[model samples]
Target: MPNAIRRYVRFIDRTNEIVGLIMMYMIFLMIGILLYSSIMKTVAIPPLWTLEMAQFVMVTYYMVGGGWALKNDAHVRMDLIYANWQPRTKALIDTVTVLFLIFYLCLLLYGGFSSTSYALKYGETSYSAWSPYMAPVKIIMCFGIALTLLQAVAQLFKDIAIARGEEIS
Candidate 1:
C-alpha cells in the first residue's frame, strides 16, 4: 500500500479508538444520572431533566462509538457463509459490500447535516418540559456518522489490500 493510504488508515483507526474509549465512559454518566433521578424521586420530586439527559447521553454514547465498533469489527453480521470463506475471498466480498455501507452512511450524514442546520437556524428545541436545544445532539450525530463513513472507507482500502495479498500496517 502507498504511504498516504497507510497513514490515512492509521489516523482514522487511532481517532476512532480514542473517541470510542472516551465515549464508553458515557454509560457511567448515564447510570449516574438515572441513579440521581431515582434517589431524588424518593426524597423529593425528580428533576425534569434527569431522564431526558440520560437519554441524550445514551444517544451520544452509541453514536460516537459506532466508528470504533466498525474498526473493531464488532458490528453484528450474518456470518454463516462468510465465516467459512477463505481470507482473500472474505476480503474481496467485504470490499464490495462496504460500498453499500458507504453509500447508506452518506445519505444518513446528509440528512443529519440538514436537520442540524435547521436546528441551528431556528433554535429548535425538544417538545418536552425541559426543552433542550437539539442542535448539539444533531451535530454530534453528524460527526459520528462522518467518522463511521471514514472508517468504512478505510476498511474498504484494507480489504482491497488484503485481496491483493498485501497487508496494511
Candidate 2:
C-alpha cells in the first residue's frame, strides 16, 4: 500500500478503536444504570427514564460498536467452511460479502440520515414519558453506519489487494 492510503487506513482503525472503547465503557454504564434502577425500584423510587435511557445507550453502543467489531474481524461467520479456504479464495469470498454489506449499509446510512434530518426539522421525540428528542440518536446511528461503511471499504481494498497478490501492509 502507498503511504497515504496506509495512513488513512491507520486513521480509520484508530478512530474505530476509540469508538470501541467508548462502547465498552458504555456497557458498564448501562449495567450500572440498570442495577441502580432495579435497586431504586425495590425501594419504590423507580426512575421513569431508566428504561428509555438504557435503551438509547444500548442502541448507541451496538451501533458504534459494529465497525469496531468488523475491524477486529469479530463478527460471526461460518468458520467451518471459511477456515478451510485458501488465502485467495478467502479474499474472494470476503470481497463478495463486503460488497453486499457496503450496499446494505449505504442504504441504511441514507435512511438513517434522512430520518435524522426529518426529526430535527420537525422536532421529533420519543413517545415515552421521557420523550427525548430523536434527532441525536438518529445522528449517532448514521455516524455508526458511516463508520461501518468506511471500514467495509477499507476491507474491500485489502481483499482486492490480496486477491491480486499486492502487498497491503
Candidate 3:
C-alpha cells in the first residue's frame, strides 16, 4: 500500500477508536438518567424527559461506536465457514464482502444526511411528551454513519493488502 493510504487507514482507525472510547462512557450517563427517573418516580412525579433523553444517549452510543466495532471486529458474523478459512483466504473473502457492506453503508449515510437536513430545515421534533428537537440527534446519526462508511473503506483497503500477501499495519 502507498504511504498515503496507510496514513488514511491509521487516521480513521485512531479517530474512531477515540470517539468510540469516549462514547462508551455514555452507558453510565444512561444509567444515571434511568436511576434518576426511578428515584423520582418513588418520591415525586418523574421527569418526562428522562426516558427520552436516555434513549437519545443510547442511540448516540451504538451509532457513533459502530466504526470502532468494525475496526475491532466486534460486530457479529456467521462464522460457520469463515471461521475455518486461512488468513489470506479470509482476507480475499473480506475484500469482496466488504464491498457489499460499503454499498449498504453508503445508502444509509445518504438517507441519514437527507433526514438530518430535513429535520434541521423544518425544525422537526419528536412526537412525544418531551418533544425534543430532532436535528441534534439526526446530525449525530449522520456523522456516525459517515465515520462507519470511512472505516469500511479503510477495511477494504486493508483487506486488499492482505489478499495480495502484503501486510499493512
Clash number for every model? 0, 0, 0
lDDT of 3 by residue, 64-155 (tens): 99999999999999999999999999999999999999999999998998998899999999999999999999999988999999999999
What candidate 3 gets wrong by more than 4 Å, as runs, is none
Q: What lDDT score belongs to each candidate, Candidate 1 first?
A: 0.96, 0.88, 0.95
Candidate 1's TM-score reads 0.98
Model with the higher lDDT, candidate 2 or 3 = 3
Q: Count clashing pairs, candidate 1.
A: 0
Stretches off by above 4 angstroms in model 2 are none
Candidate numbers, best lDDT first, in rank order: 1, 3, 2
Candidate 2: residue 38 lDDT (0-100)? 97
- The prediction achieving the highest lDDT against the true structure is 1
Candidate 1, residues 75-138: lDDT per residue as tens digits? 9999999999999999999999999999999999999999999999999999999999999999
Clashing pairs in 1: none
Error of 2 at 41 (Å): 0.5
